[model samples]
Target: MSGSISRRDVIQAGAAVTITAAMVSGLAERAVAGPAIIPFSVSVPETALRDLMRRLAAVRWPEAETEKGWSQGVPLHQLQRLVDYWRTSYDWRRFESQINAFSQFRTEIDGLSIHFLHVRSRHENALPIVLTHGWPGSVIEFLKVIGPLTDPTAHDGRAEDAFHVIVPSMPGYGFSDKPSAPGWNIERIARAWTELVYRLGYVRWVAQGGDLGAFVTNTLALQKPSGLIAIHLNLALAIPSPLPTEGATLAEREAITAMARHGTDGSGYFQEQATRPQTIGYSLADSPVGLAAWIYEKFQAWTDNTGAPESALTRDEMLNDITLYWLTNTAASAARLYRENNGHGPNQGVVAFPVGISIFPREIVRVPRSWADKVYPNIIHWNELNKGGHFAAFEQPAIFTQELRDCFRGVRRT
Candidate 1:
C-alpha cells in the first residue's frame, strides 16, 4: 500500500468467484440476438499449407535494379528465410493451445460473430477490463500477462486487482468473419464492443488498447457510451498547438522532430492500408512469406528489438501471430480498417473522458509529457515505462500490467 501497486497487489485481492452458474446460464440462455458461433474448428488443411508453400517458393521475386535498402519492397533473400521457417516449423496447433489456455468463446453481436477471451477476476468486486489488440496482433499479444492480471493468486497478491477481461478478435480478423458490407471502422467496432459489455450485464468497465486498438478505445471514450468508465492507452499521438518552437522543452522539441520525421517515413503502411488493401491483398493472401514480411516489418520497426526482429520476439511468437492472419485469411479486412477509419469524424481531437496515458520507451511515436498534457486534458495518470514498445502486452507484460493497474486505479466504471 505504501509503494505503487505491484504485481503482488493483484495476487493479494484474495480468492473470489465471478461468472457463477447463474451468470453463465443467463449468458447462454440470453436471446440469440447476437450471432451464434457455428460449431467449428479452425484448420487450413494439409493441401492448403503445401499449396501456399509452393506459391511462396515460386514467387517471381524481381531483382531490384540496385541492392539499395528495403526502399522498394521486402528484400527477397531475407523474406525467403523467414518463409522457410514458416513453411516447415511454424506450428499453429501449439499457438492455438496457447490462445485457448485462456477462456475462449465466440458470440454473435449485432450480426457479427465475435471471438473473445473472457477471464474473470477472483475478487468479489473486481473491475472489468476490456483489452483490444490492433492489426498484425492477435489475442496472443496478451497471453503473457493473462496469468498476472487474472490469477494474481500466483503473483503474491489478492483478487481485488484481478480483472474480468474481454479480449476480442476484431471483426474481419482472426476467427471473426470478414465484413460483407462496408463501414466496420473503429467507431463501428467500438460501438459493437459497447453493445457487447452492456449485454453481458457489466455496469462499468475500463478499456485498454494499443496501436489501432488505441484509436478504437479513443473513439469509445469520445462516444461516451453507457456503462463506459474510463480509457487507458499505451500509445499516444499528439499534434502540438504550434508545432515545436525552439523555446520548447527538449522533450517537446524532440516530439516535434520525431513527428516531422516519422510522419514522413512511418506512413507507408498507412498509405497502403488506406488506399489499396485489395491490390496488395493478393500477395498476403497467397504467399505466407509475403504475409510474414509485411507483418515482420512492423515487428522490427515497432518492437524494442534491434536489427533482427527475433531479438525482441522469438520467431515462434512472431510467426504465431502471422499464422493466425494467414489461416484466417484476414489480411485485407485488417488493412481495410485504415480505409474504413480514414478521414475520421468523431475521433479527430481530444476526448473528454478520463484518460490515463502509459508511455513506453520504444513506441514508434513517443509523445512528450508537455505535449501529451495539452491533448489529454483529463489525464489523471501519466507514466514513463522502464521498457516495452508498441506491442506492449506481448513484448513486456510486467510493465504493461503495472502501467494499466496504476493508471486505472480509482477509475470509475458505468
Candidate 2:
C-alpha cells in the first residue's frame, strides 16, 4: 500500500477481466508488452450466437403503447417487426466479415486495450484523421463512409480528398476493455487519442466526432496536442450558457426551444445513464429485448426518418450496432461514460483551435452560427444541411463523408 504507484500497479489494479461469450474466439495477437499495436479480428463464438437466438426467442412482450405514435416509447409493433427480422433474416457473420476485411488492430493505451480500424489511402500525402463513435454506436457506424474517405478516386473525389482513416472503439464499448475503476473521462480519452495518433506515427492529424465523440474532439482542440491541427464536429457542443433572454435570433430562439424541450422530455435516458447506470445495466445486460428497445428508441427519435428508423438506416445496420453491444455485454460499461461526465449538456469549454461545424437539421440541438462563432473563434467551415440527425455518420454516410472532405480541405493546405 504505497501512496504513489507505478504504471504496472495501475494496470494490475484496473485489469479486472470479465469475458463475455463473444470475446472467447477473437483474441488479440499474442500479447506484447508496452503499447504495441497488435492485429485483431472479430471471430464471435458460435455459442454466443446460440445464446442470442435463445434470448431473443424468450423475450417477454410488453403491452403496446396507449397511443398510436412513439410518444410513449418505441411502438410495440415496430419493435416486434424489427425483432422478427433480427431473429429470422439478420446475419451477424456478414457484419463480422465486412468489418474484418478492414485493417483492424488493438493496442495498449494507458491501461486499457483500445480496438481500432486503420485504413490507409493509396494516394500519397493523405491526411490522417481519427473518427470516434459515441454510445449506442460503434465502429459499425463508419463502415459505409470508410471507403469514400479512404479512397476518394473510387468514390468520385480527387485524391487530395483522401484521408488515412482511423476509427477507435471507445473505452467500455465494442472490443475495447471495460474500465474497472473510475477516471476514464473525456479529457483522459483525448490524451489517449493523442497518444494513439503519435504511436501510429502520425505527425499531424485532424479529428471528427458526434455525440460523445464530439466531446472528445472538442477536448482535443482544448488540449492542443502537439500534432492535432483541427477538429470537425457534426454535433457542436457549444450552447451558450445563460441562454439569451432578449435579442436572440430566430435560429437561436428555435435552438433554445429545442434544447428546453429535450431537457424536459427527451432526457430520461440521459438522466438515468448519468445518475444510475448500474440500475439500468441489469435490464440491459440480461434481456436482449430490453437492450433493443433502449437503443431502438434513439434510432427512431434521433434519426431524420419520416416515421421509422429504417428511413434513416437499414434494419441490418441498426442491428449490427445493437448486436455488438449485446455480444460484448457492454451495455452498463458504456452507460458509465455518461456518469463519468456527470450528465453535462452542451456547456463544453471554448475552443480556439480551427474548428469545423456541420449542422444537421435534426441534430439533438443544432447550435446556431452565432453561438458557434462565440465558442470557436477560428471557425474554418460551417454548413447546415437540410437532412440527417444526431447519428450523422450512421444515418447519412455520404453527406457526412462530404462534410469531412470539405471541412479539412481548407486546413490541409496550410
Candidate 3:
C-alpha cells in the first residue's frame, strides 16, 4: 500500500473505521505504540439540538447599549436579530453534513483525544501543511480554504501549489477533549502537533495559523521539529519589550496607538480569561445567548468589516463557528488557554527556522517588517495584504490560500 490514503478509499467506506498511525505511515516500530486513529463523524444528539433551541428561545436579553454602535458590547438589537435567525433559520445539520463530507478523525496525544480534519490532495507530491485554530474558533474556520488548498488545479492554480491539509481542534476546543487539569499551554500544544504530523509519516511539511494558533505555529518554529521545514503566520508576534516610545515610524506609531487601544478597550475578554476562566466558564457553559454574545463581540471587533461583521463574513459563516463552540460546550475550556499562557504572548525569543509572514491590514496589530525581523531571524517571505483581518482564511480564503502558496513556494524545494 502507498504511504498516502486515497480520498476514494475514505469516501467509499460506508462507516467509520479504525486506522492506526502504523497503518498511516508504514512505520510500525514508531507508530504501533501510539493510540489508534478513530474515524469520526459529527452527529450531534437530537436532544442537544432541541435543548439549544429551547435555550435560544428563552434568552433573557439585556437592554440596548447606551451609546450607538458596539460601544459597551454586542448590541441588544443585533444579538436579538441574530438569535431570531439562529432559532428560526440557522441550520446546524447543514454545517454538520459539510464537515462530515471531509475526512475527520481523533487520536490521543499526550493523554488527550485530539480531533482533526485531514484532506489529501490528488496531486501525489502535494506539500503537507497543518493548520491550527484559536479560541472562539474550531476546525470549522479552515473549511472554506480546504477545497482551494487541497485541489489547486480545480481552484485555478498549478498542481505544485496543492497541499495535503490538516486542521486540528486545539485542546478544549471543538470536538477535541477538554483538558482535565492545568499545564496545557501553547508549548505543550506545539509538542502535540509535532507528534501528530510526524506520526502521519510526513517527511516534510509547513504550518500556518492566526490568533492563538499563531502562538502555536510560532512555537513550532521555535521547537524546530523534524519534517517541519517552515511556517507561516497571519498574525506576527513582533511586539518588542519596553516598546519603543521614541523614533517611531508612522506605521510603528499607528501600531503603538492600536496596542494602547487594545490594552484599554479590546482586552476585557483577555483579562477575564487570563485571570478567571473558571468564573466566566460557568456562564459560557450554561447560557447559549451568553456564548453567542461573547464570540459575536470578537467577530465585530476583529474582522475586516465596515461597521458590521456581516460586511466581512456572512450570517451563516459566523453562526457555523459560534455553533461549533456551543455544541461542543467548549466556551470555558477554550478560555483556559488564555490563563495558561498568563499573558506571556508568543514573542519568546528569536525563531531560527525559515518563516513567512502575511500581515492583514486589520489584524489585531499590524506588525511592521522591521519589528518582525527581530523575532524571526531567517525571514523568507513577507507580504502586507491590502485587506482581511484577524480571521484571515474565514474572511478572505482565496487571498489566504494564495498567500500560503506564495510564502512556502521558495522553501518547497528545501
TM-score of each: 0.86, 0.91, 0.93
lDDT of 2 at 94: 97
- Measured by TM-score, the strongest candidate is 3
Candidate 3 residue pairs in backbone clash: none
Candidate 1 local Cα displacement, residue 120, angstroms: 1.6
Q: Which stretches of candidate 3 lie over 4 Å from their true place?
A: 1-33
Local error of candidate 2 at residue 389 (angstroms)? 1.0
Where does model 2 exceed 4 Å of error?
1-34
**lDDT at 155 for candidate 1?**
66
Candidate 3 lDDT tens digits, 1-414? 211122222222234443333222222323323566777777776667788898898888777789998999988889999989999999989998899999988888999988889888888668889999887777878999999999999998899888989999999988788898999999999999998887666667899989899999999998888878899999898898878989999989888898999999999999999999999998988888898899999999999999989999988999999887877778888999999988676477888889999999889899888889898889899999999999999999999999999998887776
Answer with 2 or 3, whichever has the higher TM-score: 3
Q: Rank the candidates by TM-score, best first.
A: 3, 2, 1
**Cα lDDT of model 1 overall?**
0.73
Question: Candidate 1: where is the Cα deviation over 4 Å?
Answer: 1-44, 60-77, 345-347, 412-414
Model 3, CA-based lDDT: 0.85
Instruction: Give the range of the ten consecutive residues with the poorest summed lDDT in model 1.
Output: 1-10
